[model samples]
Target: MASIRRLVLDVLKPVEVATVSFARELSDLDGVDATAVRLVETDREVQNVTLVVEGEAVDFERVEACIESLGGTLHSVDEVVCGEFVPEEHVAHADATWLR
Candidate 1:
């Protein structure tokens, strides 16, 4: 069975620099290592931006809380994606790593 991890991504208020930093930080997460978490479109009219996050389910809630703490509104959270590693694929390299 897969050890499913959860994740949630939050978009901090965007200034180019802040968005860049957020993207970098998110890339270092456990399951989803996203190189980009960008504001695609915005309601600059009201300051609402459509932010996209590429990450995993295991770390979802914590990530959501983080965004809220950072002054970003979490508009929605859906199970957008999932991932799993097959142990059988590692059989050939069983002695090569510790995760198995």
Candidate 2:
């Protein structure tokens, strides 16, 4: 089986949990080399964030569990890269019609 190299997730977390702490915890996970969390939106109770995890072999189950432990909900998986290498994503002009 191929290893998971990267994962992009949409997560909703309680405002009480600081994004820095959340990101640090994820970065500490085994097989995870780094994590980047970007705030997408926020409200009084929750924060919407996009989390990107990159590593040699990211463990999805562990990532999910960590989010839940921090009182966060995984909204959706936006992107996933699995293989021996991570490739740069390319978008053709025709495929980006919505950008105009």
* Best TM-score among the predictions, by candidate number: 2
lDDT of 2 at 34: 94
Which regions in candidate 1 have their CA more than 4 angstroms from the true location? Answer: 1-17, 42-52, 55-58, 83-100
Q: Which TM-score value belongs to model 2?
A: 0.89
Model 1 lDDT per residue over 41-91, tens place: 555332333444454433665555556655566765533444553123225
Number of the top lDDT candidate: 2
Model 1 — which ten-residue stretch has the worst lDDT?
1-10
As for model 1, its CA RMSD to the true structure in angstroms is 12.2
Alpha-carbon local distance difference test for all models: 0.49, 0.95
